[model samples]
Structure formats: structure tokens, C-alpha cells
Target: MRVAVFSFPGWGHLRPLLPLVRELLDRGHEVSVVVAERFAAAAADTGARVLTYPSRFPAPVPEVRTAEDLAQVVVAYYEEAFAALPAAWAAFADDPPDLVVEDALSTAASGLVADRAGCPVVRAFPGFAGNDEVPLNGSEPEPGSPDLDAEHPAIAAFVRGLPDRLARLGVGEDAVARVRARPPRANLVFVPAAFQPRVECFDGSFAFVGPQPPADPPPTGWSPPADGSPVVLVSLGTSSNDNPGFFLACGEAFAGTGWRVVMTTAGHLDGATAAAMPPEVELHAWLDHHAVLPHAAVVVCQAGAGSLMDAFGHGVPVVVVPQQPDARVMARHVAALGLGRCLEGPVSGADVRDAVLAVAADAGVAAAVAALRSAIGSAGGAARAADVVERVAAATPTDGGSQSAWR
Candidate 1:
């Protein structure tokens, strides 16, 4: 079978799908990954055809301060997807893919492409999966809250522009709308079912097959301190690491303590700032999370899905500082599940220290983390995700729709 996988720009988005790509290739299926030029090498490394598109969706996207700014960022991402569609069509116009797998965050663009190709699609959620009870993309305003798009004009414009984008792709709005109205043949979520919010609300249409570890993970040149002090790993993910304040706070929080701190700056810190950080805090431009996670007693980070999964997969608790809406949702779940503590309002060295110490000592949090780790291991990761894709592909008719495999 021939499969086409569509991805969003960030590494956080593309990384989770690589294991599935490798799995398909190993199973003797032809695979093509649609990605921006920036991510071509990573996709190509999987031994699949790399379809490149011109995307101005900047990596380390500029920090968004308001809903309007965030809406504009959303518009930019959709526009990037719009640019990718023509290239995808040009490649498969005559002989299309048997199946299409797309990032759940990118469903609109990729689903429209699948509609034009007459192929079945499988949506992969690297983060939360939403339903009637809790919506993912967007939903009506809550109670007396204002309508999102109405209050945010850019979002309103984005909603209005959808039809035109479909028209340009030679796909009717109804065809794309139909794809959205019904769930895909399979929904692959790269997190354990235990981690999901309102897990009972999601039906068999979703498969919560936890994250895949990297095929060739970077070498861990890191080692624990000879003094045997506890280690704390601090990060703010790739895109949002521009906040020097958070890193500075972490440095102060662990200074003169028995806990040693390891931080990945992602090139966000200047020489002066790096020099200013206390000696107890070690800084690196980049480090394989695998290098630090096993030795880590606790993880302090901005609540990103990938980071959270890595921490939980290692059975280490976390202290989360959320930077966005989706992250906030993840933080809430972390707190509710007893997996970690969520920090709110203005953060300080004392606050970071307190939260990390609290979670690290809490026996309940450790037990919860251990149980989630077990659940993630049992969730089957990439192998099960591949099984779902193959089943969906085999069951789906040539018209690119299926009802038999709703898993």
C-alpha cells in the first residue's frame, strides 16, 4: 500500500509521527511525508519520499501575547497548509495514495487533500483528543463567554476563508465538511488512554497508542553528578524557550541545594545570561531528553505534550508552567490525575522550588506517575498505531471512506 503522511511545521508536531513512518516502511508499504523544507532532512532520514512545501511558519514562532496574535498565528499555519496542498496534488494526481495520515491539529488542510485524492485519512493527535464533551479545535462560547471568532476578528476571518481555500484545491466545501462531520476510520493518539481527559467520553474511534521513542536517539554524553545529588531537568520546549526569566528562576531555585539542575537553553539565552546563571545549573544548547530523563528526579517545564510524555514515560513527576491554551489543558490534567503540580500566576524561584519539592516528595504523585508509565507501556506505542493504519487502509473502499474499521 502507498501512504501519504501530512505534518505540521514544528519538531514537536513531526517527531511523534516518525516511528509510525518507520513502521509503515518496515511493513513493505511505500510512504511519502509532506513537510516544510526545514523538516525535510528529518523526514528523509526515515527512508520515505519527502514532499517539500514553501512555509513561512517560523520555527520558535514569535511569542503570542493576545488572542488576536494567536489567531494570526493560526492563520499563518493554515496558509502554510494551503501552500502545501498544490504540491501534494501535483505528486499524486494520477496515482493517489491508498491512505492519508495527518496531524490532528492539521486536519482541515490534510483532510481536504485526502478528499481530492479520494483516499481514507487517519488523524494523529500528539496531544489531547477532543469530542462533544471537550472540543479540540474550537467550540461555541461557554455560558456567558463571548464567541471566540466574534471576539477575535482574525479568527473570524479564518473561518470565512475556509471555503475559498477548498475552492482553490478543486474540492467542494461539502466534501471537506463531510470529512469533518464524521470521525476518520482511525484516530491515533500518541499518549496513553490513561492520560486523556474524560477518557470515557471517547469511543472506539480513537486509539490512544502512546508515544514512540526515537529510532536513532541522540547519544547521551551526560552523566549524573559523582556527589549523587538528586537531578532536576528544566526546559520550556523548543518554541517557547525565549523566556529568560523562567530559566533564571530555575537557576536560583536549585542553587545551594542538594538537587543539581540541568537546563536545555535551545539557544535562547545570551552569553551574559548564561554566565550569570549559578554554577549549580548546567546549561546546554541542546541535549537528548533521553540523556537526562532517566537520571532526573523531577522535570520542570512549560507543559508541552512531548515533554510531558517523556517525563511520565520515565516515571518521573513534573512541575508544569503552562504557556498556551493547549498546554494549560495538559497542566490541568496533570494536576487532576495526581501526576504532577501545576504552577500558576507570576512564578518565582521560591514558587518553582516549592512546586518541584512538593511533587518530588509526594508519594501519591510517584505512584500515579508509575501507574501512567505502566499504562503507556501497555498502550503499544508505534506498533499498534501501524496496525490501525493497515487495517483502515485494507478496509477502506477506493472511494476513500470506511465504516468497518472505526478504530
Candidate 2:
């Protein structure tokens, strides 16, 4: 079988899918991946033929301060990204693949391509699958407030512009709606069922496949300190590490506490800030999370899905300081699950210290982590995701629709 995969530019979106792509290749299927030029090299490492495209919009500004700011960022990103769909389809015009697999956020573009080619498309959720049962992007609706009948002005404007944006690509407004509303043959969710909000409501159309293991090997020359103090790993994820204040706060919180702190800046931290960190803290631009997670007694992070799920996989509790709405939702869920505590808004070093200490002292957190770890282990990570893909490809009709059991 020949498969084409689409993903957004961020590592959070690309990393989860690589393990599945590699699994498909190992099974003798031909795979091609379409992603931003920034991720071309990383995608190629999966052994899939890689196709890179350019975006008209500039990368999202890291210092997103408000929900409005984030919503605008989403609109700009999709507007620019979907603009590239025509060229992407033209590249495969002569030789279309059997199926299209894409991250959930890439639905607009990938959906258009699948519709044009008349092939079944699989939607993969690397994090939360937004539905009526759960709040979108981790935003909680105010209690006693009526649901709005109309979309937000910014969002409505973006929706209105969709037709003009993809008109050149032969995707009409109705086609776009169908792509957005049409359910996938298989909805591959990369978190365990226990981690999902209101998991009982979702039918078999969704598979609660657990987190994919890191495709890369563990970092070399890194070992846990032999000191008996507990280890705290701090990271802000790759896309949103622009906040030096958070890192500075962490340094002050754990300084001289006998606990070893390993912080990853993802190359966003400045030299002056790094030099100012306390001697008890070790700062690096990046480290193998899979290698560091096992030794961590508690994780201090921004609650990105990949990092949060990885901590759970290793049975380590977390103190989540979410920087975005989606991450705020994950952090809330973590606190609700008894797996960790959340620091919601602008926090300080003392806030970080208190949350970390609270999580460390909570015995229940350990038990919760252990339960989630077992659930994740049994959810069939990358291998199960591959099985679903193969099944969908075999069962889907060539006329561009799917007749899979889940559908």
C-alpha cells in the first residue's frame, strides 16, 4: 500500500506520527510525508519519502498573551498552510496514494487533498480530541452562561475566508465543510483512555492509542546525579520556550535545595539567563526526554501533550504551568486526575516551588501515575495505530470513501 501523511510544522505534531510511519515502512508499505520545510530533515529520518512546502504566513509569535492572540495565530497559520495544498496535490497528480493520514489540525488541507483524490483519510490526534464532551483547547466555559449561537468574530471571519483561500485548489465551501465535519475511518488518539476527558462518550470511531515512544535514541553522556535528592525535570516544550521568567523562577525555586534540577530550553534561553542560573540547576538547549523522564521524581513543564504523556508513561507526576489554552486544559485534567498540580496564570518562583513540593508530597500522585502508566502501556502505542491504518486502507473503497468498521 502507498500512504501519504500530512503534519503541521511543529515537533509536537511530527514526532508522534514518525513511530507510526516507521512501523508502516517496516511492514513493507510505501509511505510519503508532506510537512513544512523546517521538518523535512526530521521527517526523512522516519524512512518515508518527504515532501516539503512553504507557508505564506510567518511563524506564530511565541509571546502569545491572550486567547484572542492564539485564535488569530491559528487563523493565520491555517490560511497560509492551506494555501500550499494546490502545489502539494499537483506533485502527486500523476500518482495518487491509497490513503491520506494527517494530524487533526491539518484537517483543512489534508481533507481537500483526500476529497480530490477520492481516497480515505485518517485523522490522528496527538493530543486531546475536541468534542462536545470536552472543552476546546482546555478552555472552560463559564458556569450558567448560555452557549453562543454564533462563532467568535475572528473565527467567523476565518471561516468565511476559507472558500477564497482554497478556491484555486478546487475545494469548494461545501467540500471544506464536509472535510471538517466528516468523521475519519479511524480516529487515532495518541493518549490513553484514562487520560481523556469523558472517554465513555466516544464510540469505537476513536481508538485511544497511547503515546508513541521517542523515535530517536536516548541522549548520550547524560546520567542522573548520584545524590539521594529527588530529581525535577523542567521543560517548556519546543514551540513556547520564549519565557525566560519561567526558567528563572524555577532556578530560584530549586536552588540549593539538595534536589537536582535539569532544565531544557530548546535553544530559546539567552546566555545571560543561563549564566545566572544557580549551580544546583543544569541547563541544556535540549535533552532526550525519554532518557530523563525515568529518573525524574517530578516534572515541571508547560503541560504540552508530548511531555505530559511521557511523564505519565514513566510514572512520574508533574507540576504543569500551562502557557496556552490547550495546555491549560491538559493541566486541569492532570490536577483532576490526581496526577499533579497546575499553576494557571502568571506564576513566580514561589508558585513553582509550592506546586512541585505539593506534587512530591502527595502519595496519591504516585498511585495515579502508576495506574496511568499501566493503561498507557496496554493502549498499543504505535503498533496498534499501524494496525488501524492498514485495516482502513484495505477496507476503504477506491471511490474516495471509507467503509471500515469504525466508520
Candidate 3:
């Protein structure tokens, strides 16, 4: 069988998709991963054919000073991603694929050709909120409840722009009509089914594929102390580490403590930022997450699903400081599930140590982590996902125009 996988630019988005792709390759299917010119080599690590497209997105402007700025940043991601679709199709002119597995956030699979090729398209939801329409981050003054305002600035922009973007994609004025009329063959959600406990509804073509990490974790450049001074990993994810003040605060908090802190400041920070004389701080641009999770006593991060899920699988407690919409929602679940702790606002390193210890000290937290890990282990994960792909490839009917969400 021939399979084509499409991934977005960021590591969070790319990470979850890799395990599933690698599973397909292990099953002996011919696979090709379509990615940006910058990420082709990274995608090729799975041993599949790497198909590159010229990505127009700038080095992710991860610093969100306000709601309006985040709105603009998101729109830019879509525009650049949208412009690359036709070219992606042209790259596959010779032998069209049997199936296309794509990032749920990307609309590339909607290009008229892939459907015309009579192939099934399955979307992989890597972050929080899979295919749901209702926002899950309602933990504040409740946009519908109390602590938060009744406004979602980011979602509103995309909703308003939907008509214009659809027209630009040649979906016509009735694009929303088409969305209502035609969804996709199936959606393969990569997170566990229990994380989202919501009252609202969404398109129902989604599946759960559990949490999966690369079979091989990377080797870290630094090692923990032999004396075992509780090691904690402090990361703001790769993109969100643009804020220097946050790192400064962490530097102050983790200083002079028995805890050994390995900080991934990302490429956004300068070396001078670490000059505050904290001999215990180890800073680097990136760490091979798969390589380091086993030794981690706790993880402090931005609450993205990839990091949270990895920690959960390893029975490592987490301290979540969400930086975006889904991040906040996911953090709520981490706390509610008793698997970790949640920090509501801007975080300090003192807050990091306290939260990490607070969550790690609870014996029930360890039990919950072990329980959830057991649940995830039975999710039929990568092997089941491979089975579904093979089944779809065999059953795909010729002639694609309009169909049900589940084909």
C-alpha cells in the first residue's frame, strides 16, 4: 500500500504524527511525508520518502503580546499553509496515493485533487481539542461561566475569515455550506479519549489512537546528579520560549535549590539571559524529549498535548503553565485528572519548583499516573491505526464528489 502523510511546521504538530507514520513503515507500506523545505530532513528520519514544499511561514512569531497579535499570527500560518497545497499535489502527479493522512489543523487535504484521486483522507489531531467546535478552555470567569470574558478573540477571527479563505481556495461562497455538506472520510485523533470531557458536540468522524512516542528516545547532552537531587525539566515548548522575562523568573526560582534544572530556552533566548549566577541551571536550545523523560522527576511546561502525554505515559508528574487556548484547557484536565498541577497565570521558577514538588509529593498522583498509563496501553494504539489505514486503502471507492463524514 502507498500512504501519504502531511504535517505542519512546528515540532509539537510533527512529533505525534511521526510515531504513526513509523508504524505504517514498519508494516511494510510505501510511505511519503509531505513537509516544508526546512523540515524535510526531520521527517525523513522515519525512513519514509520526504516530499518537500516551499513553506512561506516566517520563523514562528511565538511571542503573543495580545489577543489581536495571536489572531494575526494564526491567520499567517493558514495563508502560508494554504498556498502550498497545489504544489504538494503536483509533486505527486505520477502515482497518486492510496490514502492521505494529514494534520487536523491543516486544510491541505481539501484541495479538489486529492478527493478527485478517489483516496481516503484521515486527519491526525496532535494538540488538544481534536475535531470539537466548542472551546474547552472555559476555566476562567467562564466566557459562559464567570472568571473569563465572553470573548474568544482568536477563534472569532478565523470564523469571520472562513468565508474569505474559502472563496480564495475556490470553494465558492457556499464553502461553509460545503463544510456542512462534506466533512472527511475519517479523523484519527492521537490523544486518549478520556482527556476531553465536554458537554458540546462536533463532527463525529474522529477516532482515538492513544499516546505514542518514538520507539527510540534521544540522548541528552547533560546528565543528572549522581546524588539524586530531584531533576525537573523546565520547558516552554519550542515556540513559546520567546519571552525573556519568563526565563528570568525561572532562573531566580530554580537558583540554589537541591533540584537540578535542565532548561530548554529554545532558540528565541540569548546566552546573556542565563548570566544570573545560578550554578545549578543547565540551559540549551533544545533537548531530545524522548531521551530525557525517563530520568525526569517532574516536567514543567506550557501544557501542550505532546509534552503532557509524554509525561503521563512515563508516570512523570507535570506542572502545567498554559500559553495558548488549548494549552489552558489541557492543563485543566491534567489537574482535574490528578495526574499533575496547573499554574493559572504568568509563571516564576519558584512557582515551578513549588508546583513540581506539590504535584510529585502526592502518592495518589502517582497512582493516577500509573492507572492512566495502563488505560493508554490498552488503546490499541499504533497497531490498530495501521489496521485502519490498510482497511481504508482497500475499501476506498472510486469517484469522489461528496460523501458522509465516515466513508
Candidate 4:
């Protein structure tokens, strides 16, 4: 099988899909990855053939500072992405993919590619939010906050009509209808299923995929935390890592606690600030967080699904400080699952210490972490996901002059 994987530009979106790409390829299928141009080589490192696409926006769109900003950037991104379909179609058709895997926000192409090339498109949601219903993130505006008006109404409507759009590109209207009719695109949720009880709202078309196969190391070198004390990994996440004050606050929180801190400032933070750490804390542009999270005793992090999922996959407890729209939802899930505590907004050192201490000292919290880990193992999510994808592919027979294939 020739499989094509697509994620928007963000690290949060790309990281989860990485392991599955490897899984498919390891199972003896040809895989191609479509990602932002900057992330092309990163995907290539995993041994999949890489294809590049122009992102709707240029790099550095700024941090996910507020709900409004979240609404604005995401809305604009999908709007521009929808408009770019013609070019994207041309690029993919030049070398057609047998199967297309898509990240949460990459909906239009899912219907388009499957329609145009007669392939199966697997919709993967990176966050805990499984679909349009039981929203992992905010589907509707918060009660008190200014309503997040979907500014891109034109594209929003266009996305709703995606099946018809794909039909024009040769995906039969009924076939395209079947694809869109499945809520949230036959999604596979990468987070723990116990933490997510309401996924049924995605209409049984979706199934939990568990975490992507365990992440692997990049063929590059970056120093791991060398501090002597039990290591604590602190990261605000890929897009929200720009807060200098947050890092300074974390420094204060861990002071004298004897916990050597490893903070991945994600290149947005200044090295000088990290250099000034009070003897124990080590700060750097980025770390192989997936590599480090397993070794750390506790993770003090943004409620990025990528960051927390990596921590949970290793049975590590979390101290969540959510900074974005999705982070808030993720934090709630973390607390609900008993793995750790959630802290929103500008987190203080004292709060960080308290959450970390709570996770460390309380046997109950440790049990919660263990329980989550056990639940995932019981579910067999990765295998289940692979089965779902293959089953879906098999359901739609192709008569384009070739025998059917399976993994």
C-alpha cells in the first residue's frame, strides 16, 4: 500500500502522526508524508518519502496568547488552507497516494484526496477532542467570554460542503457524502480512552487509537538534562513556548526544592535567561521531550496533547499549566484522570511546587498514573486504529485496474 500522511505545520500535529507513519512503513507499505515545508526534512528523517506544501501563513504567527488569538489564527489557517486546494490537488495528483492520513484541522483535503485519487483518508485528531461533538476543545464559545465568532464564515460553509466540492474533483457525491457523513472524519483519538468518555458523540465511526506508536529519537544531538537532582521537564508547548516570565516563574518554583529542572524554551526563549538559572535549573531552546519525559519523575508542562500524551505514555504524572484553548480542555482531562493537577494562566513557582509535590508525595496520584497506563494497554489503541483504517479501506473497493491491498 502507498500511504500518504498529512499534518498542518505545528509540531503538536506532526509528532503524534510520526510513530504511525513508521508503523505503516514497518509493516511493509510505502509511505509519503505531506507536511509544512519547514517540517519536510524532519518527516524525512523517519524514512518516509516527504512531500512539501506551502502553509497558509508564513512562519512565526506569534504565540497562542489568548482565546481570541487561538480563534483568529486557526480560523484563518483553515480558510487559507481551503483556498489553496487547487494547488494542493495538483501536487498530490502528480504522485497519487493510495491512502491519506490527516490531522484534525486538515479536513478539506481528506475528502478531496480520497475523491480525486480513489484512496482512503484516515482522519486523526491530535488533541483529546475526538470530534465536532463532545468537543475536546471549545466547539462553542465559553459562556462569559466574548464569543469566538467564526470569522471565516465563507470557509466554514465551504468546509461543510466539502463532499460536494470533492465530487466535482471526481469523488462521487455519494462517496464523498459517506466520508463527510462520518463525524469528525472517522477520527482516531491519540489520548487515553478512560480520560475520554464522551467520544461516542463522534458517531461510532470513530475509535480510540491510543497513543501513536511510541516516539523515536531524531538523528540529531541535543544535551539531555544534566542536573543532579531528580529531573523535572517544563515546557509550555510548541506554539505557546514564548513566555519568558513563565520560565522565570518556574525557576522560582523549583528553587531549593532540589529538583533539577529541564525547561525546553522551544527556541523562543532567550539562552541568556536560561544561562542565569540558579545552579540547578537547565534551560535550552528545545529537547527531545519525548525522550526526556519517560526519564523524568514529573512533567510540569503546558496541556499540549503532545506533551502530556508523551508523559502519560511513560506513566509519568503531570503538573499541567494550560495556555491555549485546547490546553484548557487537556488540563481538565488530566485532572479528571487523576494523573496530575491542572493550572491555568501564568503559573507561579509555588503552585508548580505544590502540584509537583502533590504528584510526587501522594500515592494516589501515582496510582492514577499507573491506572492510565494500564487502561491504554488494555485498549490496544494502535492496533485497533490500524485495523480501523484497513477495514475502511477494504470497504471501498477500487476497480482502477489493480488488485486490492491490506497490511
Instruction: Please report, in order, the local distance difference test score of every candidate based on alpha carbons.
Output: 0.82, 0.80, 0.69, 0.70
- Lowest lDDT 10-residue stretch of candidate 2: 398-407
Give candidate 3's error at residue 166 in angstroms. Answer: 11
**Model 2 lDDT, full chain set:** 0.80
What tens-digit string does per-residue lDDT give for candidate 2 at 134-166?
654534653443443236687788778767766
Task: Pick the lDDT winner.
Answer: 1
Error (Å) of candidate 1 at residue 360 is: 1.5
Write model 4 residue lDDT over 10-42, tens digit each, in one string.
887787777778777777878878777778888
Per-residue CA lDDT of candidate 1, range 1-407, in tens?
99999998888889889999999999999999999888999999999999998888866665465556667776776677666777887787876888899987667667766787777788898887776786772233334432234446776776698778767767777876676775677799888888887778787878889987433335777888989989999999988788887898789878888789999989989988888888889898899888788889999888888999999988899999987545766787789999999997788988998888999999999999999998987888889999999888877256335343544
TM-score of every prediction relative to native: 0.89, 0.88, 0.81, 0.81
Model 1, 15: alpha-carbon shift in Å? 1.4
TM-score for candidate 1, residues paired by index: 0.89
User: Candidate 2: deviation at residue 100, Å?
Assistant: 1.0
Clashes of each: 0, 1, 9, 2
Q: After superposition, how far is residue 162 of candidate 3 from its true place, in Å?
A: 12
